[model samples]
Target: MSDIPQERRVLTAIPGPKSVELQARRTAAVAAGVGSTLPVFTARAGGGIIEDVDGNRLIDFGSGIAVTSVGASAEAVVRRASAQLADFTHTCFMVTPYEGYVEVCERLAELTPGDHAKKSALFNSGAEAVENAVKIARAYTKRTAVVVFDHGYHGRTNLTMALTAKNMPYKQGFGPFAPEVYRVPVAYGYRWPTGPENAGAEASAQAIDEITKQIGAENVAAIIIEPVLGEGGFIEPAKGFLPAIARFAKDNGIVFVADEIQSGFCRTGQWFACEDEGIVPDLITTAKGIAGGLPLSAVTGRAEIMDAAHSGGLGGTYGGNPVACAGALGAIETMRELDLNARARRIEEVMKGRLEEMRAKLPNGAVIGDVRGRGAMIAIELVKPGTKDPDAAATAALAKACHAEGLLVLTCGTYGNVLRFLPPLVIGEDLLNEGLDILERAFATL
Candidate 1:
């Protein structure tokens, strides 16, 4: 498979024959409320490309929303998963415990940042991990309020929706959110009202101060944040801001939770983004790429904090599915043996080089307002030239053009004006360059 030629061949138009048939069937059989990114239907996928039902090969930069860090159809991942399935499919960890589940938890203890004794509980999705984290925080701190930053996306569940910032799609008619949830401004340098050039410390300090004043730090159970904002435009918090928040949370007895669902597992160069600042979060939530596309999420934290919840309160029927545990174990081994953290840095080097070049050339390029993110988790925010106003229309146009040209990309942001790149860390340089070229051409059209 490695020797197979890597080429993009459009045998038919994007929604060609089979895809049109499927789309028609989908309209009838699937929910009318379903949303789609591209009309193209996927038939197969390998290293860095997804083959549509029309047989069109397109470079993939979304990675199933960053759940396949080792690439779709990874050899080791497939092998391990296949072996696990051969042994047994499900015993329901709660009903019958397994060694693989325990092994995966042990690995989490070792890998997740912190030298302190840690404990972990697995779940089926990032939201579950987040919800569990909240439960643990409440139990430990005996507080009711959970504070989240603006533009932060925790999940779509009732409690998480309250924690999430976006209103339109996520929380539009789903109102009357969970109680005791407080919102604060994030350190988004691009549109920060205070100004971008200044150190974000002032804005962060102000946010902390306001939260403390309004809710009283003692009443806060936890302060959850994504180290590099995920759906919030992949914005990395400014220097000193994260550390300051960490210190504040510690001093106030607030559980500092780092939601690394989209930034973990070498996606941000470091195993975890908080490691960049050397800040130790009281609890860390992980999912997405953790189990190589299998559904698994975990909350790892200080043993004492984790122990706050009763044993019966934590376990879920399918929390640590054995197959997912096996897949996670294999995924971790693959990352270690293949050195995907270093690979992520290499990808950043290639992508940054191309993006910086694009930034330098185009005049309308002010659409590329900011290019930031650590390692393979990168994004470019689109904006009206010389202003912080979001160019959401331009972002949609660029994404449409790229899709038409056989390149898959994803857009994210509070304003829906940013293009985020989450290609598998194993993507080849040639494929990466090809995707970048497609993006360049798309920008040219814009």
Candidate 2:
């Protein structure tokens, strides 16, 4: 363990020998439908770096799309998972049940925001969590209509794709989507028709009014939103937006669901981004980093709403596998012991400071149109200067340059022009700075 190298050392060009050879094999053996962010295949990862199969180490800003918050290969996680593997691997929660599954639910009830009595159901991915939340909402309210916002991404499932607003990749050729799902304008400040200068309160009010007028609140079962829009350029709704939506949902008897699949578990400075405004959502969907790297997703909500579903109405064959439960237990313990929430804030401090400097220095030349997001879940929207048009070319160029220099980053957004950063909170300051420096240089060259 002590012999592991701490810094990145690029021995060969990114794809190198092994990765290139593997890529060719993968293209032949694997599905071409699958896409890759980086051509280099990973050999190992720890702290903030990923070593490719070619022996080239690169600084990782994308934590497996925010799945390794505690860092790739956390010591406690490894030990706990290994021990659990020796004890038992599977015994479906619904069929045989297990203590680890119950314990995970208990932890989720205790951790998720809200003092109300809560219950949880585990699943396999963020998409399943989302679908279950909708199912629970419909059962509880006995309503057919579900409300979502523009730019929101639920998942790739049939129902979630209907809820998701993007086309081409997520929704195109996949529809006709599930029925009774309605979409309203999101309070996206940058591209908002009213513009960024407008108060968030006004935009949210208008959105609420429009939705109520179109669908009539009485017909709605729930209103789902991401506290911080993930694939939507990390857009943080205007200040009063979330709180206003919460209030409206409460008054209309609509189930307020916060999709924290990407923003939960200290990814945002707080345990959940909804806590930023002291809003307690009726239902919360989570996954991604919930069980370290293991597959586990959950829907935790008010006890009554969760219980509305009849016995056996919810669950899956591998919903709460014992091994995943163990991993979740360890992941939660690691988070609490390490104070990762504070670490997220620390990451934000460093990131915001550097990004602001970048914004100032390259005001005109820099393609970064806007920088926003809370805690470690940060993103910079790229656009042509003096216009809101997306600068996809510039964004692509920057990402490629960074990868060539031994850095891993990701691009997202409805227009595919926003560069998102989801570095593991456990990443050392030196490594984090190195990745940032590479990004700065890439922007300068652009």
User: Model 2 residue 93 lDDT?
Assistant: 82
Give the alpha carbon lDDT tens digit for every residue of 1-446 in model 2: 11246587889988798999999999999987778999899888888888888889988899999999987788777877889899988878888988988999999999999899999999999999999999999999998899898889999999999999889688778778899999887788888776776747667887798778988999889999999999877889877889999999999999999999999999998889999988899999999888888999999999999999999999999998888888888888889999999999999999988988888897464567788899899999988887779998888999999999999999989899999999988888898889899989998788
TM-score of every model versus the real structure: 0.97, 0.98
Candidate 1: pairs in clash? none
> What are the lDDT scores of the predictions, listed in order?
0.89, 0.89
lDDT of 1: 0.89
Lowest summed lDDT window (length 10), candidate 1:
1-10
lDDT of 2 at 89: 89
* Local accuracy of candidate 1 as per-residue lDDT tens digits, 1-446: 13324677777777689998999999889996667888788877877888887778888899899888887777777788889999998898878888988898899899888899998999999999999999999999999999999889999889999999989788898888889999987778877676665547876788898887999998999999999999988988878888888999999999999999999999988889999999899999999989888999999999999999987999788899888888898889888989999999999999988998998899787778898888899999998988878999999999998888888899999999999999988888899999999999988888
Q: C-alpha displacement of 299 in model 1, angstroms? A: 0.5
As a whole number from 0 to 100, the lDDT of residue 350 in candidate 2 is 92
Instruction: Score residue 392 of candidate 1 by CA lDDT.
Output: 97
- The reply for model 2, stretches above 4 Å from the true place, is 1-4, 197-199, 363-366
Model 2 lowest lDDT segment of ten = 1-10
